[model samples]
Target chain A: MNIALFGKLIQLLIKEKMAYRGDFLLSAFAQIVSYGGEYIVIWLFMKRFPLLAGWTWPEIALLYSFGLLTYAIGASFSFVQMRELEGQVRQGTFDNLLIKPINPYFYLISRGFNLAYVAHITISGAVLIWAIGQLNVQWTLLNWAYVLLAVVSGAMIQAGLLTAIGAATFLWVRAGFLFTIFFRLKEFISYPLPLFGTFIQLLLTIGVPLAFVNFYPAAFLLAHDSAPLPGWAMWLAPLVGPLVYGLGYLLWTSGANKYQGAGG
Target chain B: MDSFELHRYVYKLPVNAFREQLRFCMDLLSVGEFAHKPVRQLSLGQRMRVEIAMALLHEPRILFLDEPTIGLDVMAKDQIRQFLRAVNRKKPTASPGRNLPGRSLPRASLPGALPDERRYGVTTYMMFAVKSFTNQLAYRSEVWLRLLGNLLAILIQVEIWRAVIGSSGQEGASLDQMITYSILNPLLLALLSTNVSEAVDSSLKSGSIATELIRPLSYPLYLLAGSLGLSLYKLAFTVAPAFALAGLLFGVLPPASPMNLLAFVAALLIAMLMSFLLGYLVSLLAFWLMSHFALSWMLGGLITIFSGSFLPLWFYSSGWAAVAEALPFQYLGYVPAAVYLGTMTDEAMWRTLAIGLIWAAALLLLVRWLWSRAVRRLIIQGG
Candidate 1:
C-alpha cells in the first residue's frame, strides 16, 4: 500500500530491463507479433462470417479491446505474482517474503514487471478505437462514465481471477496445467459468449464470470436490443470485479498461512 | 530450398550423437547419480557408465576419447574405455554430404566391420540407435504409418481444393481456392513440430546441450537426423493413411501430369527445409536470450499466418500479398500449393523456387554466424 515502495519497484525494474537492450526490444516485438497474430484469427473469422451471433464488427472489437485492456492491467500489476508463484513455492522462497516488514503479497506481486507486455495493450487499444469509430455509438456523459467504470472494474475482475487461480498453487503444489486451462478459456472468452453451447455459456457466465468483463459491459455501451443478459444484469457487471477481488484476497491469505517454506 | 538438405539438417541423429561421442572420446567422463542429483550421488566409476550409455543414445559415427580414464581407478577406466571402443566400432555412419562434416564418421572398424557397400560406392549404413530385428520391425511399422498419415492429409487438401474450384475450368480456382488448399497443412505441421522443438531448444540452452554437443558430430546435424527419422516415420504412417482416407471420403483424381507431382514434392521439400532452418536460426537466439520460447511462439505464429498455410496470401490486398511473396513464408506454403493445383505457371514456379533458395542460404549463413559466436561464448563460460 505504500506509494514509495511501488515507485521504487518501478524504477528498479526499468533499470534492470534497460541493461539488457536486445532482450527488451525483442521481447516487446515478440509480444506484439504474438498478440497481433492471435487476434488476426478472430478478425479473419469475422471477415468471413460477419455479425457473429448477432454481434457486429464493433461489438467484437469492444470485446477484444476491453478484454485485453483488463488483461494487460492485471498482468502488468497484481497478477505478476501469479505468474511466479509456482516457482516461488516450489523453490521455498516464500519464507523470505514472510519475514519482510512490508506486506508479503505486495512485494511478491511487485517483484516482476513485464514492461514489454504493454505492446499488447497498445495494439488492443488501437483496434478498439478503430472499431469504436466504425460503430459510432452516440456517447453521452453518463455513457462515458459507464465506459470508464467498465475499464477499471474489468481489469480488477481479470486480475482477481488470475490471483485466485495462482493462490490455489499454494494448496495444490503441482498445478502446472491450470494455467493452460485458464489461457484456453480466456481465448474462448474473447469471442461472443453466446456462440457456445448452453452448458458452456452457463459455466462461463456463472462459474468463470467471464461475461462480466467484456460482453456485458459492451452490450450496455452499444445499447443494442439483442444482448443475451437481461437489462438488470448489465448493472451488475462492474460489481463483479471488486467482489471477486475481495474473495481472492481472503483465499490468498489462507494459502499463505499453509506455506511451510520447505525450500527456504 | 531443397527438402533433402532440410532433411539433412533436421534428421541429424548421426551428427549430434557423433559430436557428443567425440567430446567424450577425448576425455571419457561419467557419473552414476541420477540426473538432477549432485555429482556425489554415486561411486565415481558407476557414473562413467552412465556417461557412456548417454553417448550411445546419439549412435555417433566418430567418437573422440579424451583422458576418459584419468579420474577413475584402473578397473573403472578400463571398463569405461572398453565401452567407448565398443560403441565407436559398432556405430553406423549416415551418408557423407547428407551429414555435416566431422560427424559422418565411418562405421566401426574391428568389432563391427564397415559394410561392403563402401566398395560399390553406395555406402551401406545402419540406423545406429538400434540393431535388433524386433526393434527394426517396430520402427518400420511406425514410420510407415506416419508417412501414410501425411499422404492422407495432402490428398484431403487437394480434394478440398478441387471441390472448391470444380473441374473443366481452364484455370484452377482463385485466391480462395489457394487458401482452402493450404488451410490444414501448417496446422498439422505446427501441432507436430512446435512442442518438440521447444523441448529440444530448451534442453540445448540449459547445459544438457553439453551432453549432445560433446559427441563426434555437430549438434545441429544430430537434431536434423532425429527430425528426418521422425518425418520418415510420419510420412509412412501418417501421410499414407491420410491419403487413403481422403480417397475413400472424397473420390481422388490423378495429377494432371507427373510434372505436377514433381512440383508438389519439390515445393514440400523446400518448405520443410526453410521451416527447419528458420526454426534452428531462431533456436540459436537462445544463446543471447535466456528464453527462446517467445521467439519460437511468435515465429511459429507468423509462419502459420503469413506463410499462406491457414489462409492464402492472395486473400490479402495486392500490396500485402506482394509483400508476403517477397518473404520466405509464402515460399513455404502458398507457392507450392498453387503450383501443385496447376494455378501457377512454370515461370512462377521457378521464381518461387529461386526465392526459396535465397532465403535458405541467408538463414544458413545466419545460423553459422550465431553458432560460432555461441561456441566461443561456451568456451569462455567453460560449460
Candidate 2:
C-alpha cells in the first residue's frame, strides 16, 4: 500500500523490460506502426470526405487522440492485470496475495504497470499535442487545467472499466470472454457517437458509460453540444472517473470476499 | 447442442453424427462436469479427461495414449483404467507401453509399425489438418464473440459508407455495392486468414518443431494443411453465421453475375493458400529476429494497410490503390472482396484467380528454401 513500494515495483518492471534493448526498441517501433496504421485509415476516409458529423479531420484527430491517450495511460496500469485475472482466479493463484500483509488489489495493480504501452503513450501524446496546435482553441489557464484533469479522469475511467470487467472473473470463473468483448466495444466510442443511433448513444452513456472516457470530455472541451444523455456530465467531468472507479473498487472488494479456497 | 458440440462438423462420420456418444464419452471420463468450461479453466487432470473423451469419440482401434494417468487423482486414475478395460474387452486398445520416436507403438507387445508408403501419405497428413480443427474446440466463447463483433463491424462500415456516399451517391461505387464490400471484405478475412505465424513461433521456440522437421513431413506443408483446416472451421462457424446474419439484417446484394460468384469462391480458395504462405514466410523470420512482437506487429500492420482489408483499394487514391495492387497482400483481402463486389469483369476475375495461384506457388518455393537454411542452422546449433 505504500507509495514508495509502488514506485519501486514500476522501476523494477522498467528495468526488466530495458534489459532486452534490441527487443525493446524494435517492438516499440512496431507497435507505433501497428497503431499508426489505424490512424492512416481514418485519414484516408477523411480524404474521401472533407468532414464527418460536421467535424474536420483535425477535430476528429483530436477526438481520436483523446481515446488513445486515455487508453495508453489506463492500459499501462491495468492491461496485464485484467488480461491475466481470469487464469489467476481459476487457478486460485490470487491466494498468493492473501498470504501477504499488503493490500492484494494494490499489489495486483502494481505488477500490471507494463512498459509496453510506452509506444502507445508516445504516439497518442504526440498526436494530442499536434492536434491541439492545429486547432484554434483559446489558450486559457482554466481550459488547460480542465484538459489535463480530464485526461487523468479519462485514464481512470478506462482503468476502472477494465478492472470492473476483470472483477466479474470471481463470479463467472471464466471471464476472459468479456475482455475480448471489451476491445470490440471500445471501437464504438472511437468515432463521434452522434453518428450512431439513439440506441447506441443510450448504450454508451448509461449502459457501460465508456463514452465518458473520451467522447464527453472531447465535447466539453470543444464546447460542442454533444453527449445527448446526461447533459450535466460535461460540467461534472472531473467526477466521472472517480465515480466509476469507486464502483469498480467496490466490485473488486465484494468479488474478493466471495472467494473460496483453492478447490473451486 | 451448444456450438461446442462436435456433431456440427464431421457429419459424415457415423460415430460423430450422434450426440449420444459425445455425452457417453464425457460421462465416462468425468469431463462432462466441466464440458462448458474453456481449456484454460481446466486442471491438468481435467484436460487429460477431455483429450481422453476426444480420443474415445471415434472408438479408435489403437489409441496412441502416452502416460494417460500421469497427473490424475486416485479416483480419476481408477475411472480411466476401468474405462480402458471396458473398451479393450470389445476391441484392442492402448496398454502401458513406452513409445519410441522412430518406432510406432501398437502390435502384440512391441509396436505395429506402418510401412512407409506414398499411398498412406494423404491419410497421415490429414491428421495435421484435423488437428487445427480440434485445437479450436477449446474456446467456444471466442467464436460467438467474434461473430457478434463481425456483424457489428459490418454494420458500422455500412453506416460509414452511407455517411460518405450521401444522398447524391458516390463516384464509381453505389451504396449497395459499398455495403456488399463492407460485408464481404471482413467475411473473406474471417474465412481465409489463419494466424499460422503463432504456430511457427511456438514450434520453433519450444523445439516441438524439431520433431516435425526431422520426420518425413514437410513442415511448411504441415502448416498449410493446418491453416486450410482452420479456414474450413471458420467457414462453417464464423463466415457462414456472419454471412447469414449480415445478409438477413442488412440485405447484402447477390453477385453482379453468376460468373462473379464462381470467381469469388475460386479467389477465396487461392487467397487462403496465399495467406498461409505469407504468414509462414514472415514467421520464419523469428529464426534470426530478436523478438516476435516486432515481427507480428510489423506484419499485421503491413498486411492491414496493404491488403486493403480495412479499406478497399478503390477507396484509396489512384496512386495508393496502385501501390496496393503491386503487392501480393492484396489477394488476402482486396481481391476476394473486389471479386464479390463485381469490380472486375468476367475475364478479369479469371485472370486475378490465376495470378493468385502463381503467387501462392512462388511463395511456397521461397518457404521451402528458407526452411532448408533454417534446418541447417538448427543442425549447427545441435538441435
Candidate 3:
C-alpha cells in the first residue's frame, strides 16, 4: 500500500465522520461516559473493600486504565472490521480487498480506523496519570520507557487476537459469536488476574495470553513483588504482542487464500 | 395410535373430534403419511402442518399466522397455502390473518383495498408481537450466544461479590442475598430491554417510517407491541434459562416472603412497560437527530448507573440515592430486584411501584405527542 494513499484514506474517513459534527460529538461523549462508568464501578468496588485480591485501589485503577487504553487503541481499528467481516464475506464484497494491490489485512485494518476511540484513549490516559499520582510511584526514565513499550505491546496483542477471530469468518461464515466470546474474555484482564481462580488465571496466561495485555505489565510497573506469575513472565510482556500479531497476520492471510465467493 | 393419539393425550379433546380435525389437517396439508411419526422426528413441513392442526383445533373465529411457511420448500409452501385456502373455504366465517401488513388479503379484495377492517387493531398488534416472538425463535444460534454471555457475566459478578464481601456482608444485604440479587439483576433488565431505539433510528434512516405511517396501526403502538413480544421471548428462552443455570451453580436464595414474590412480579411487569416507554421516547429523538447512536449510549449509561444494574442504589451516598429515587431509571431494574430481595418494605415497594406506574403513564403520553410532531415534521420535510 502507498503511504500517501493510506494517509488520504484516513483523512477521508475523518472528514466523512466530521461531516456530521453533532452526531460525532455526541458519539464521542457517549464513549467517554461509557468508559467512565466502568471506572466508577471499579472505584465503588474498591470503596466497599480496600483490597481486591491483594491490590490497592490505586494499583487496580492503574491496571484497569492500562487495559482500557490498550483496548481502545486496538479496538479502534479491529472491532468494527471484525463485526463487518461476516456481512462482507456473505455478500462477497470481501473479494474487493483481495483484488486491491495493497495487502488485504493492512487494508482491512486501515479502513476501519475509527476516531471515536480518541475518547477512550483520552479518558483512560487521564485516569492512568491520576492513578499513578495517587500511588506516588517513583518513576525513573527506564520505568517510563518500559511503560510505553508495554502499552504498544498490549495494543498489538489485542489487535492480533481480534484479527484472528475476524479471520474465522472466512471459514465459518458466521463467526460473529466468537467476537462476543473474545469481548467477554477481554473483560477478565481488566483487574488483577490473581483475583480469579487457577483455571481463569491459567487460561488468560497461556490459553489466550490476555494477561500479557494488561496484568503482567501492570504488575511489573506497580512492583507487586507478590505477583501471581513467575518473575520472568513480567519481562516477556513486550515480546508477546509482536509474536501474537505476527501469528494473527499469518492466520488472516491463510483465511484470505481459502476464501471463496458466496457461491461456494 | 399416532400423531392423532399424541394430540389427543396432550390436548385432552374428544377423541372423535380430534381425529376428524387431525385427518382434515393431514389431508388438507398432504401430510397423511407423517401422522404416525413423533412431532420432533417429523420434517419441518410436516411439523408445521401438525402445528397448524393444533392451532386450528380450537376453531376460533380468527386465525393468526406469522410466516407460517417460512423456510419450507416450494412444494411445502404451495401445499400449506392450499391447505389454508381449504380451511378458509370450509369455514368461511373464520378469517385467516397473516402478520405481514398488506400481504395475504382475500383474493376478492383488490390491492387498493388493502386497508380492510382487520388491517389494524389489538389483534393485529398481538399478531406483531407473536411475529416478533417467532422471529426471535428462528435465531437459535443467537440464543446460545446470549446464554453463554449471560452465564459468563453472572460468573464474573459472583467472583466480584465474593471478593468484596469476603466472609462479611455489606449493609442491608447478606452475601446470599447479594448473590441472588446479582443473578436476578440481569434477568429483570433483559426482560425490560428493547431495541425500539435502534429500530426507530434505522427505519427513519431507510425511509421505512413512511410505510409504517400508512399502516392502520399507530407506529408507536406497533413498535411497543413488537418490542413487548421480543422481551417476552427473551424472558422465557434466554433469561429464565440463564437464571436457572446460575441458581443451580451458585445457589440462588428464595424470595423473603410470598408477598414479596407477588409484588416483585407486578413491579417487573410494570417495569417492562416503563422501560419500553423510555426506550420509545429515546427512539423518537431520531426524527430530529442525525443519528441515535450517541443518544442510545447515553441512555444506556444512565440506565446502567441510575438503574443500579451494576450495584444497588443503597450502596450509594444518600445524595446519590436520593437522585436515583427521584428518577425513573431505578424502577426499571433496581426497584423490582429490591422488592424481590425484600430490601424494601411492603409500603416502600408499593410507593415505588406507584411512582413507576405514573412514570409509565407520563412517558406514554409524551411519546404519543412527540410521535404526532414527528409525523408532521416528516410530512413537511418530505422525509
DockQ per candidate: 0.18, 0.55, 0.53
Show model 3 residue runs off by greater than 4 Å: A225-228, B1-120
Model 2 chain A lowest lDDT segment of ten: A223-232
Candidate 2 residue lDDT tens string, B1-383: 23234322322235444466677767677777888886767888888777777655655455666667775678877777776766666455444333332444443322222122333256445666776787776566689888998887887777777777865665578878888888988787777666788888887777676545633445666677788778878888888999999999877998877878888888887888787777787787777782466878887787878888867787798887888887888998888888887888778878878888888889889988887776666666654
Q: Candidate 1, which CAPRI tier? A: incorrect
Give the runs in model 2 whose Cα sits over 4 Å from its true position. Answer: A230-232, A262-264, B1-120, B214-216
Model 1 chain B scores worst on lDDT over the 10 consecutive residues at: B116-125
Expressed as tens digits, the lDDT of each residue in B338-383 for candidate 1 is 6666666778777777778888889888888888887666556654
True-structure lDDT of candidate 1:
0.62
In candidate 1, stretches whose alpha carbon ends up further than 4 angstroms from where it belongs are: A38-51, A54-58, A78-80, A225-227, A261-264, B1-186, B192-212, B225-272, B285-301, B331-362, B365-383
What's the C-alpha lDDT at position B176 in model 2?
Answer: 80
Say which prediction, candidate 2 or candidate 3, comes out ahead on lDDT.
3
lDDT tens readout by residue for model 1, A81-124: 78678888887776778999987777777777557657788888
Please report the candidate that would top lDDT against the real structure.
3
lDDT of 1 at B368: 83
Interface RMSD of each: 7.1, 1.3, 1.5
What TM-score quantifies how close candidate 1 is to the native fold? Answer: 0.64
